[model samples]
Target chain A: MSKVSDFFAEFVRRNGATISVYLFTAVIFWIAVLIVLPQLYMLDFSFRFNLPPSKIGTEEDVHTLKNYKYLLFGAEGNPNAFNWLHLEVFFRTIWAAVLVTILNLVICYPVAYYMTQVISGGKARIFILCLILPFWINEILRAFAFRILFGLNGPINFALVHLGIVPEPVEFIKADIALYTGLAYAYMLLMIFPLYNAIESLDHNQIDAARDLGSPWWRIHWRVVIPHAKPGIASGCTMVFMLTAGALAAPQILGGPSSLWFTQVIYQWFYTGGNWPQGAAYAFVLLTACIVFVLTMMRIFRVSLGEIAK
Target chain B: MSADVELDHLTIRFGNFVALQDANLRIPAGSFFSFLGPSGCGKTTILRAISGFLDPSEGHVRIGGEDMAGIPPNNRPTALIFQNLALFPLMKVWENIAFGLEVRRVPKAQRRERAQELLELIALPNQGEKLVSELSGGQRQRVAIARALAVEPEVLLLDEPLSALDLKLRQHMRTELRAIQQRVGITFIYITHDQGEALIMSDQIAVMSQGVIQQIGSGPEIYENPKTPFVASFVGENNAFTGRVASADANHAAVETHFGALRGRNSAGLKTGDQAILFVRPEILQLGAGTQGNALKSKVLAKEFEGFASHIHLANSQGERHISFSTSQEEALNISPGEEATVHFSPDRAIALPLGELAHE
Candidate 1:
């Protein structure tokens, strides 16, 4: 505590009242406008009944748990009013997001390892460019681009049919392939850069030492590389998992008829269903789940919160 | 369990640049051998070749009388301790030590037992439970050594592993490394740029420069009887005189220089009028006109006091030649800076060699 005070005192002494006041106000404004205000409004909205904008300022409006109750049990007190569909969509979103996270890891780990460790200067730069170039386009446009590629008569199906890999033009977009692939592609830079950052800092001599001690290639990664990259892997997994769960664009553009993402349901409640309270409640639930998942990942990976922050 | 290593006409070249050229050496089993040279002198390249990291562009490296032509590092009967100790920071010390055994499919209980045994050997029996990051620098060095020893490799290679330590710890670890080598009785190949490290720990030393082995000999032989101009200037400090060989013979040569005709033992056999450099160690060059031969009259340019010894700097009347000799005796303190003095050394104490590249200070 004293150390913190000493630091603050030093800071204030270095930059006197005017500059300090400006900096302090900037921080307060940032936290209030960008972070706390949104969360505060969401919290207030989640605990209230679904009131229209005209009725919002009237005495008939009241704070209640009806929105949350509806989320868990549909309408109140009716046993048959259980919203199994919404529950199914909620769980499916979590599971699909997990699958995409794992798939991205499986696909990106080797590429990242190759780019950082195996490849040399110009080649590594080119590989990084390839990873970043597609993301420069707007994400929604990228999803639509993927939609074009995975359509029934798209290039992928055209090649597969012409090559006789499939008998006819396969319906990739209608089979959830476009959605999953698009999700993995959309957030690849997030995953790759973190893993690359962690792995790049490792000394190459450590790998040589393991090899000289008779360890095979696989065991080297398992014992040395992965353990050293835990913080990176945790950060990557948390970000990718949360982004995939909360992602709205790719799900909307490429999702099949049966693929109803939880964010889509939240969108319906807010904009189409005209229930801002219920939308805010669902969004809050997703936010809490993401926070829990991040903490859980940090625990499993044995990385400290401080490490994640880095 | 150790075996001899033979580098038979080994040559390694990266593109047009030659890293090692036709080097041949036989390192006997159970001996501590060192490759001593400055950085980029191909000492590490030779070590890498022996450890199976680099394939010799030509010739062969034979380990334990087996041709190691196609063998990888992990399969070779050799283990290398990297310059940085390279202990796995994530693993406990015991796990790091046991990693090699685990790779060989040793059971967990046995691996742990052996790790414990090796830990005892390294004098860190209780440190096995600690993470590698938790150990001190010296402790980490010992663990790296123990980890290599756990593999029971026929040859143990070290790549300047002590360079990272402080002066005191490095000096201390030199003795510790020598003791461990004596106990294990394995053919240990150590690479170092520090002459003190090579001379103190190695039974045999190979001095290298410019991708070539200058000389291979025991410590005393290398220090006292350096075969090349590079070696004489490299292995230790020496007073050098560049001149023309006035006269030559198999045993002795006279060099004509600004310091006049200086005679020294000539092993390289320079003919008359050939360029040569004469070398004399400070300890051999003494103050006062006590010698019968090879004496020079000069004025003391300056004096440097180093507690136990005082270095008396001298220059000839022509001011073209300068020499410094250190003496720790009480009588030597009588000579002060800017005083006239005569310094002398015996003929055999100095060595003459045909001119070549000198070692950088």
Candidate 2:
């Protein structure tokens, strides 16, 4: 009790009472009004059915599970029929997110290792600047840029054709390759920075010691480097997975005609279908899946939440 | 099994900086040899070259009569104990010890048994289940030795492993390391800037200065017969006299200085009129002038009473030259500061060498 008061007293002394009050009020307002209130409202809204404006606030407007039921099964009268289309989109979004997370990890690990251990000084700074330069453009603009690059008449296709490696321009967008590529590129920096921060703290002597002990290059990483970088790997994987699954702009801009992402379904529900409650329920389900994925990853990697936060 | 290591005119360069100049040395099999020098004198570079972590820019390194030019560290017949030990904090102590065997696909049970045996040898038996962080500094030092020995290499390389310990533990580990080397009976190449550690633990010492080996001999030989001014000053405390050779003989030279003409052994072959410096050990300087050899008349500047002996600081009549010598505590107590005195030493106890770079504290 006194310790808590002492900490607050010290904080007040450092910032002055007026500034401390302002800072505390701002944090409270941000958390309660901007974040908690909307999530609470959405939770309540998700449990109730949408009604006519006149029917709202009347006996017809009552809390129910119809929104959730509609997700598992189609329309009211057909109880036996399953909504495989929405379910399939949900599973496919999860699968694609996992693939994107793995792709980002595989692409970022070696680059992170090289940046932290191999190169240094101005060379490292320039290498990192090149990585961050692409992200200076807005994500939506980059998605559009990717769309153009992967197009039939773009430079990629032109090179392939000129090189005589393909019979014709491959349908990258229609094949859904552009969507994955855009998502992977969009979140690559997130994975790389965490991995670099983790690996940079490792002692170079440990690597030399392992080699001196007759360990080959691969075994040295398996036993020493990767284990030391576990927390960073977990943090990067969690960020990439959650962001890829919740992503909307890249998927919509680069997805094929036949492809459907779960977020697209929720967007259609709230706008085209005029059903905000159903969209809220589906959003909560996606959030639940993300939470489970993070927990499972933490378990597999044997890392604590605090360690990952570092 | 043991193997001799030979560095044949090895040289290492980083850009324009020559870290280790053209150097040649042959370490005998099953001998404890040490490279002693100040920091950045290329001692660690030589250790790295022998361990296969570094390739000499010129010449070659041969171990056990085989050229080790292209072989990687993993395939070399050597193990290196890093300065920081570099024990894996993520693994148990036993796992760190048995890692080399594990890489060779040894069975789990056999590896564990071998780790246990090594732990016993290091006098830390049954402590293998703990983490490396749990061990004390001395225990960690022993653990590092065990880890290197677990690979059963023909040679072991140590790079100032005791530099991080406290003075007392550092002294204790010097004996422990020497005992371990004798027990293992392998060619151990140790690198250190601490002369005490090198003299106490090494059977043969190679004193280096500025990437050059100045002298290679036993501790007594290096202390008594340094070939260069740097070696004479670097290995121990000495009072130097700067002068020009007045006269020379086959075994002795007379140098004229501000004090007077001083005669000493002509180890560096100084001819007449050549610039030379005479070095005399402080312990050999007697308080009163003797009937033989060189003598200096000086005034006592200060007297520091150490437990075993007292140091007497003195200066010449003009006060241009300051000299120091140690005497018994009773004798130091009798001598008052600011009093005139004459110190004496035998000719064999001093040596006249061509003047070169002298070490500064």
Fraction of the true interface contacts (Cα pairs closer than 8 Å across chains) found in each model: 0.95, 0.88
Highest DockQ, which number?
2
- Which portions of model 2 miss their true places by more than 4 Å? A1-3, A79-81, B316-321
TM-score of 2: 0.97
DockQ of each: 0.87, 0.88
Q: Per-residue lDDT for B1-60 in model 1, tens only?
A: 999999999999999999998999999999999999999999999999988889999999
Error of 2 at B341 (Å): 1.6
RMSD each, Å: 2.0, 1.7
| Model 1 ranges with Cα > 4 A deviation | A1-4, A76-81, B316-322
Worst 10 residues of 2 chain A by lDDT: A76-85
Weakest 10 consecutive residues of candidate 1 chain B by summed lDDT: B315-324
Please write out the lDDT profile of model 2 over residues A60-89, one tens digit for every residue.
889999888887897867656887878889
